[model samples]
Target: MTAPFIPVNTPLLDGNEADYLAECIRTGWISSEGPFIERFEQAMAATAGRRHGIAVTNGSVALDIAVHALGLDEGSEVIIPTFTIISCAAALVRAGLVPVGVDCDAATWNMTAEGVEAAITPRTRAIMLVHIYGLPVDLDPILALARKHDLKVIEDAAEMHGQTYRGAPCGGFGDVSTFSFYPNKHVTTGEGGMILTDDDALADRLQGYRNLCFQPQQRFVHEELGWNARMTNLQAALGVAQVERLPRTVEIKRRIGRLYDEHLAGLNRIRRPVARTGYADNIYWVYGVVLNDEVPFDAKEAMRRLGEKGIGTRPFFWCMHEQPVLRRMGLMRDESHPNAEYIARRGFYLPSGLALTDDEIARSAAALKEILA
Candidate 1:
């Protein structure tokens, strides 16, 4: 008989998730305001090595809040990776800032400092560095560039919980950093996010933006508009539990990556995810594989075949330059991001969730070997 179908990602909820959630339910503190919300915020801020963490509704809104907190002018430009999710670009656009696109490094599948430097113009107000998949970007050079250019650094370390760059943590380096606690993330809150920063003023601004710009002195009088992107106490309950197990969660993800590495080593037609080097290792956010030129088909075809074999897979992010919405907005027209486009076409990640078992990983690897062969 065939084995049960494996999923792309699943949360590991064997911690204090239930107890804390029950506490919230029992206390009738299910809304955004509660003890767990503050506890989760504090834990996440400490985890990221920041002074303050303002919890938000989701990762996308976290980006929006971070962008707005930068206090850039309406037409200011922010450099971002072309290979990342649309939320990064949309956040800048929604904040009335232009998003300048840069291609990813062919090997690391991350935006390089060189690409970021090359994309800088006078209007460039900040560099929004996204730590893609679980590997932190080479941030020293980017930080240096920002210093020389007087640009703000927004670290979107959503995919890199517990992942470090050099000796320091990923989220600790930037002017402000953002994290997502989505179910697929290492530390999950079902649907929540946080903005981290050491700056006292920026943290205050973030708190204001999270709750519809409610004036402290007067309850409902608002001078500026803000979003109701507050993360609920119930979600924070899960977040608190997840944060307590972050180290173990990261280890499990790395172990999953290693398992796939061992099982898929002989497949010469596909390139496996990068391992740890002088920089941080691929925490294997997902065990992404890139099909070589010798492969007969692209990632879409490979995903279809893997699905047929009861193996779940997800395609890599499409390049922002080719996005229809951006095109309609007269942005990314006739632009070519070769590396981003190539990776988007060839890359896909397998079932690398924290909850995936050794047997599931082996079976998924076996299916890949058969399909690729």
Candidate 2:
């Protein structure tokens, strides 16, 4: 007889999701114009301490909207941590803006304020601050530099939905901030994202950009081209229920992180996620494990062994500087990010999903320990 397989992520959606979807179906309000869309936007905005939320089809498009809303000059440079997903760079690249790469701290795995400061130049117009894994980038010095250098701040709080920085909400920090509701996130709407902001004029632009830039004054007139990146009433229906249960979900994530910490302790050759910092503890969006140099095998070989044990694993994000596409485009031609490279090659996340069971954790840990040992 074989044991059950453990997946990397299984979203916990035991909330009012069904009830809200039923409401949308019963009332025939299933389009983006439905009542649930507005309700979800308002709920997310209020939670993030922002005056407005513009829901989008997905998080990638949300960053697209955030970047374009700022209207940064073409050929302008925006600083970004090289450790983030390709979406962060894609947003800048699509807008004809340059993405200046900076390395993150080896410990927290978040970009350093010092790295970002060094990367700033006369062409610098904005900083795309991404909160990685579960810990946030140190914002005080970075925000201060943004103020002093007059650079726009676009916060990527996709994995930090219920997280805080020095008592302030993650989404509340940037001039324009964004969130993702992918199934893996603390809040899930199946597939969705939100752009949050306090500026009234910027809020209007965000909404317009999300909906093909339709002019209310003349419904068919278009001054500028924009994306049809509208989130469905169905996704928002789930979002309404999911957003309300954020606090409970956050605790669940923290609990999952704690369990992994206990299980993987004493594995000297492996580095665990930082449990806490002065400003915040890891929300443990996913439990990342970094193998030290002494480990006999790389992540690929370890994952192969884990797979044989019916354990699902995922490798960490490949550093942006090392991305072949960027290299071919004449970017990062003469640069190196050792810390980002070190983790990307050697790290992978265990099964840290919301629906993961205690027995599964024990089983997964045993399997990995056997491989590493």
Model 1: how far is 26 from its true place, Å?
Answer: 1.4
Tens-place lDDT digits, model 1, residues 137-245: 8888999999999999999998988888886777787889999888899988889899999999999999999999999899699988999999999999999999899
| Estimated TM-score for each candidate | 0.98, 0.99
Encode model 2's per-residue lDDT on 149-210: one tens digit a residue.
Answer: 99999999999988989888899887899998888998888899999999999999999999
Error of 2 at 100 (Å): 0.8
Q: What is the lDDT of residue 220 in candidate 1?
A: 99
Stretches of candidate 2 off by over 4 Å are: none
lDDT per model vs. reference: 0.90, 0.92
Tell me model 2's lDDT, rounded to 2 decimals. 0.92
